[model samples]
Target chain A: MPREDVMATETQLYTPSTAAARRTSGLRLSRRRVIHTSLTYALLLFGSVLLMVPFFWMLSTSLKTLAEVQTWPIVWIPSNAVWENYPAVFQKTPFARYIMNSLVIAIGGIIGTLIGSSLAGFGFARLRFPGRNVLFFLNLTTLMLPAWVVIVPHFMMFSAVGWLDTYLPFIVPAFFGNAFYIFLFRQWFMGVPGELEDAARIDGCSTFRIFAQIFMPLAKPVIATVAIFAFFYYWNDLLYPLVYLQSQMKFPVSLGLRMFQTANAGVVDMPKMMAASMMALLPCVVIFFFAQRLFVQGVVMTGVEK
Target chain B: MALRIRMPKTKMARREAMEGYLFILPWILGFLIFRLGPMLYSLFLSFTDYAARGAPQFIGLENYTYMFTKDPRFLDSLRSTLAFVVGYLPLNLALGLAIALLMNQRVRGITGFRAIYYLPAVTSGVAVAILWQFVFHKQWGILNAILSVFGAQPIGWLVDPKWVMVAFVIMSIWGVGGSMIIYLAGLQSIPTELYESASIDGANGVRKFWHITLPMLTPTIFFVLITGLIAAFQIFESAYIMTGGGPNYATYFFGLNIYFTAFQSLRFAYASTLAWMLFAIIAALTIFVFTTSRRWVFYAGAREDA
Candidate 1:
């Protein structure tokens, strides 16, 4: 009933008890458990193969030389690994600069989203005000407005304000709490017991202090989740960079990779593009490995199925 | 007794109001400047035939009329996009759900299984497109090589217009991790007692799942369906990056068409109208789902709001 979202911070849902319950059930293993487990394992394996097949080929293709890649009787593994492809990506395009730009945008976006959403969420969940629901819904409606419709206007507004061709247009708006993030944090805040706040108030905490101390401390899991989601968002996003930025130095990995693909068009060095893709995928995977539990928790809490 | 209007001190209420706004100031400002301004401007842009060079001359209804009456390409694209959405949305969601259900049962190295299924999602859409492009490149690709082992013929992937959309669909299936993860979360939240009770009453695995899991998880499935439908309808990146809406425009999606009209062609007015059409279709579908969700979308742990 609450915090349903998409293109979002689903990782904000990890509360300890529910996630723990999922991991450590009180029941003992039995015949039914064994049978069910085996059946599920078969299903999981089948699905995993389906999901992994494309990726497997991608990696294998990346190791093959151009001639090898386009040869008859395509080889899954190259007789000779084309390790040079990775280096070629850097030599061929502004990939390093793109990576740097992505890192900056993602970090800026994440920090801005987390701090701004937390503050706004605290206001909505813990503080009372008129027109809150109406205003919140208004914010949510904007989510339905296709991003394309807003592009020209955003471009005009940014150019008018002289923030074009920089990360300012991409990153600045995120400092305002996004609708979904605020909704997510609001839901979590509502569930925090009121007594903790009362006690904090008695001990002379300001509303802001209570937020930073009481709510935020209880929000580490969520904060971590938002950090990961926001990181992935700005890092991989393509359209915004394509529209707002023109300089090669300003390209994120998404748009930069596009340039690589375009430049290599028709004479595509498959290995090079695949290598760049793998490189782009690395940070997100690494973060997911560490934050998988929190990520699942965020999904559960937000109920962000769609 | 007279009903006394309990008037609170104006200062406290005023301060609370100010603080609420202050807390939400970041979001409000962004919504107005970043979101609202663009949204309104785009609506206005949709009507005029603004040739990119000068002031938008009022060409009321012309763009919309052209799309319906004269533009055969628009109709072709609409059919292609809608068919693509219809085909992909159901297929991917089903695959994702089935996998999630399987993974819900306790299995060895479940987390690793999760990571594997989720691999493509981490790689991002562009990477998926690049990888898949080479995999299905017909004569020179690994896919046909694998098929040849089973004595199957080579199939043109990106080049052939007929199989182009299918290629996109097949490629899209690789990233089921996003929805699958949500389904897993939905599974985690099912009060185990429901399953226990069902089994105790002689429900087998299938029955227990049907009676318990399916009902309990309907809300999530519904959410996924609506969002998936919306997302599928607007799929742009893979088609854009992989096919360039090409091979006779077999996969030129409406979203891409709109983008081309607005950005590439700089037909801002025509692009605006196209965007409006997109907005209308998506909005209509969202409302339809919301209204019909009453028949399904069960909430566990609490009653649905009246």
Candidate 2:
């Protein structure tokens, strides 16, 4: 699911040539270069506008009165940007508890994945234990196994351990290293110059220390990429939280947003739900844009680059 | 620092024996205690008839036998699941690649357009479900509004059993931004020299794309295609929230069926069997992909096309 976003960062740059072609296609203007540049800017402005519509629509709906939201001939702009909905969102439906729960799950997931994947990745790339290739391939095998294949066992397992209604079920497996993250980290680690680790070996640095102090530090980019991925996934998690969490207080934003719809039932509150949904997704979008550089690095060339 | 007495005739430091275990200990423990242990327990329980409350009753092969004969819903859901996977895989790849191609043309403001396309990908599934529900509503929805302009009737997006899968497909299209990113990245990785040479050889855009870009991107596409197919098979959340597997069980997807049987109907034994079957299928499919990928995936600088 995540591997594709890494594709976008580099491929998206080629869009400029469309503008170049479009300008040249339409006109017999002598100053083709200037027209192409202006046309490119115009397309860019258009693209920006198109992109902003959904966010703006979400915000406006969130602010509009309930009546205003359901009205036909949709309101393109809100009379006022309602600051109150944010507060209302928090006030309604244990939103604060859900937010806290999301934060804990997201953080715990990141920490666990970072520790688990880094060690496993380092082992695969640098260490030579028995059945190393087999173990690494076994780890990679998990990549294609859909979560549904194990959801029943996963649910029962957590329930039996009395981990249901707690964050443990959500956070624990992440610590064991996700197959994708381990693969990414190992791919990144494989490129870390052997000379460096060898020098550290001669300096009496432990394998673990070299992994900790040297490889760990050097693998920050991939680590950041994995962290960003874990954050988005945890943030987007619906099935896990839906199954594991029985209590309303334990619900994360993902499940919490669903409640807004289910709570409303047939008489769907399109405005409030849309607004709340938009708010719920803000962190994911923000984090993605912020950590995009790492994502690009992962997609383009990580292991093979060095 | 160089007081190494031949480093005990090994490159590995002595500290590795201790810290190595320490580093992996958390993950190993997590896997054993949280995932692996429970998974084994569930497998054992599947062989027995153990409801959450009742004591275990040994019933080996009963659940599996019942699944093949008595479980009609499982069959239905399996059909839906398979249909969905077939539809979704091609649609996602095509749409994602199309957007990537459009954005790949060196257009100005491509960044903003890329971000817009990517926005829905990052949006919560809950929000997306909500938005899609409204958009696909039989009447008074934006999609219907657009359709009316083209002289088409309103669609029963969330209702009508026949059209239910289409609803999921529409929703899926709204989220192609992430895959678009990956295609974009793959595009960027291809050296410009290849395209330039192709252009000099009288290759037009489409021909160049077919000859160079698509071939260069075969690896990422294959990667996305396999993973995407697996994901498509596990379609639970959207069907759960939007349709609730209703409209006369039109969208009763396999994952949703498992959830209902296990959680709602308290049929863990049956659910586990269903899950196990899915696991086997996924395992087989993954193996198939791994075997075939070598034939088509063209890794950079690799000789003989793989």
Candidate 3:
């Protein structure tokens, strides 16, 4: 979510003429310049190694034997790789079901956020209304109020409707448009030239049809951005599930992973724990790698563009 | 531009207003039911002793009074959260800016470096807790192993009460990539001409940064500081999963305290008080930041050119 600011700056930094000029300027690098550049790379490489160690350790330990994991001097490599630890995570708990639960919530959240926020964004951006400004202000106010503020009442309200321990609480809210996403969509929609909507209207298209056929089709970038953020949010969310869900069968991978850690607190089964952590983290890393550009765009839309 | 034929202005305006409302209906419903309704209900619940099973028993300002005067846990939670904020926020800002400045250098393969740094932000929450537990394990952990190589005794990172917050702060700083990204964006926006002119005036790298870079990046820093503090104050999942707010509640952050109070103790009203207190703190802090921003946050215009 934070990378988009870099994109905003990058656009300014890397315009064709400016980039060309900078490239030409780089060609005249002196011995001092070369030394400075090497120093910069060295510092960055060192920092990157420090940052990457935990991840490297996670992968390394996941393949280690339980005995190897606890060795003094911290065995950098396992004498015997425990490839079975990955499957053991599933064997020790309902890890597969937990993964399924996480997918359901994350996907559900993405769909709801896309539909709800886009429509609301289209409304706030294009459609003229008497109370539009007021409504949008109200929407922005949600950003100031922490989610925990309403959590108690939300739990009670959901419980009253017999929705506790179900995915309804997590999924339903997404269907109603998140404030930040709505703002993102509104900003994106606002940037779409008014001429397109006007041309569509001239062809006798209704407002909803104009939004669905014209604006929605052109909003793929924003939609993808919202989807990635929503997926990230629901996938890592532990507090909501902790409060509202009680049954093991209903738990998402996040809650399930935490429970796994707590259940095995007395045992030093580091390899299996690392394996479970890896399993839980895999989807997000995959999504991030694939849609890296969209992720950066999302951050830009929310941060610098604001 | 569409259908510019002489339709009555009033009819057209009314139709557009209606269309806007229709498009935004989902958000309005969501706001009223999910956000506003829950907020007001939570406010009401804050004044009553409402267990999950029964009706709310109104008890005036007792909840507020009890939190202020009698609750040692509340104060402890507040103090711990503040300690976390104090430790985490400044380091996050400084490191974020430093890494950003480093990353902002015209270095090759910088994107690859960014992707590596951003790995932690995406793979946070439960996975992070599990990984950090292994890293900070009292004995035979990788961190302790490294400390031993330096001829230093291994510190009990997550065990000893004095050091748990420091451990959490370290974990928090590990994901500074988001803020760093934002800073890169801010740095990018400082017109290159400004730097060229500064260099012309005999400014070195440090002088250019102090004069040109710092002022221009103030807006981004302000944003990061506000959001970072807000996020730190709500630190819960890691504390809950890692130390379980333990070592005699030294790591008991306000969010976890509210969670335990509501879920474990089933004291809904008291929890609501805690939640409101959190909201108040965040809101006050945010407002304070915004108000104070005028003094230091350098907007592009509406002032004298520097």
Candidate 4:
């Protein structure tokens, strides 16, 4: 599909035809290419440095002493690395418990999203159903519905049910299938060849069995994309937790970090706060580095499809 | 092509329909319980007067009337949000596209550069805000330190009401990588032959970009602008964490206003009214975008209502 061409710009730009043209043009092309490549490198390098400064500052501040962090000249790097700030993050607050809370929520969210989105996506993509188009359209409309629209009543509903200060509000919704992820999975599922499903159907497989035994097993890539998105969503989510979970014990990392910052309002411990920020930011950065392609693919597919 | 068969729904088809519903049951249940239920409750709540403790009393648009006529904070938040959207959206779109254009060049280690630029996109909003808070500190901030290098006096980023929104705008621009990748995909999708052909027809680089690239990228640009505007209007986390909707409420975005109204003041009914206003605004804007999109957003294939 044209999508493959779009996604793999790396390979497309370095195609053999272009290499052949460069080779045929020889020295002039080589010199021009050298200048062109250098100019590209210079521009990108400057941009990369500018972009990396905040991250670099975060890491630098995380290891600096409080005095050094607040010093006038702005310590680009500390004269001494206070590795104890990382330990101090746990020592001063319930950082470990916050991480645990975030992990439980993120993991729960991922599991629920995968199961719910995959099942619904499979049904929508592969099954013939009355009212399917209407139902799908309704689901798609929810994508444009901002979260704050229902948040007030959602809070009151949860409060009525006495589910406040628990992870229920954050994790439970993920089990119902997100509109965006369902759409993503539906798109992926639609591209799967009909031959496999046909063969499974010929074997007298039940519809659910066809999905489970045939489709779900082959849906690793889309599942990963959904899981990654859900993980980040849950881990970084602050509003729902802030509104629902009032206690420090129930606070996820995002809320925990916010609370920590607020608690130090007047004093402003830059090193410790930054250390906590790095810990909160680490998992997402690591995940993005590992699954950069999937991240890019998800963004591109959503934009194009919409 | 010569023979066409149309089959009416039979017993098998009805059974398939039932199975489809069964598969999608979780989502349906989830939607009812979580999405549709809360939405209806919110609509009802908007017409009532309730603080957390008592049964909501029917107030008949009193909350909405108060918001429109009496509240200063409400108007301030609306103005601030509008200003933020105006400032952030264009910079995000332009910077995202410019960076993407540079990244599109055939350079070695381009992925590394992309990764660096995208790092902020993955970081939690709370964490990013905390980091930027340090960077925007009145004294000893790296930004001020850099200004010192150029013999320019330090300007308060978060301290001054005039600059706090600008600081938030800068932070939003830092995450432009998200849109940049989408633009990159759009650029990649445009066949290189279009450029080759244009060049052959005596089009220079500037003319080619104006005639070919921008027009071809209209759909993507439209997507970015719509989503960016929606996201900008809903600005919450950074304002909540960094500014706390202050330096005299300069960064008090609409989302933060709803949040504070509901959670902090416990005015569920008023918050509901505010939430509905946001919903209506978003819905109207989305409809506007869709209506206006036909004028400029070019599609190479079958078009769908955005």
Clash list (residue pairs), candidate 3: A4-A300
Give the alpha carbon lDDT tens digit for every residue of A111-146 in model 2: 989988888777777765444566566565555555
True contacts recovered per prediction: 0.63, 0.40, 0.77, 0.76
Model 3: per-residue Cα lDDT over B75-182, one tens digit each: 889989999999999999999999999889889998898888777877787998889988888786777787898898989998899888889988888898888877
The TM-score obtained by model 3 is 0.92
> Relative to the true structure, how large is the alpha-carbon lDDT of every model?
0.79, 0.73, 0.86, 0.85
DockQ of 3: 0.51
Badly placed stretches (over 4 Å) of model 2 are A1-57, A78-83, A301-306, B1-41
DockQ of 1: 0.48
Q: A1-306, model 3: which lDDT tens digit per residue?
A: 246346545755658676555445546546578898899999999989988888888999999988887767789988878899999999999999999999999988889888999999999999888767878988987877777888888888898899999999998888889999999999999999989988988999999899899989999899888888899999999999998899999899999998898888843778899999998899899998898778777766665654
State interface RMSD in Å for all models: 3.8, 5.8, 4.6, 4.1
| Residue B69 miss distance in model 4 (angstroms) | 1.2
Best candidate according to lDDT = 3
Task: Write the number of the candidate with greater DockQ, choosing between 1 and 3.
Answer: 3
What ranking emerges by lDDT with the best candidate at the front?
3, 4, 1, 2
- Ten-residue segment with the worst summed lDDT in candidate 2 chain A? A1-10
Two-way lDDT contest, 2 vs 3, winner? 3
**Residue-pair clashes per candidate, as listed?**
5, 19, 1, 0
- Report iRMS (Å) of candidate 2: 5.8
- lDDT tens digits, residues B19-57, model 2? 445555654565566556656666777788876668778
Model 1 over residues B1-306: C-alpha lDDT tens digits?
233433346886766667877898888888878787777787888788785777877778888889899997788678888878877888877888888877776667989998888767666756666777777777777677877999987888889888887888777777778788888888887788887788668888788878888888898888678768777777888888888788887887888888788778888778778877888888898889889988887766566678
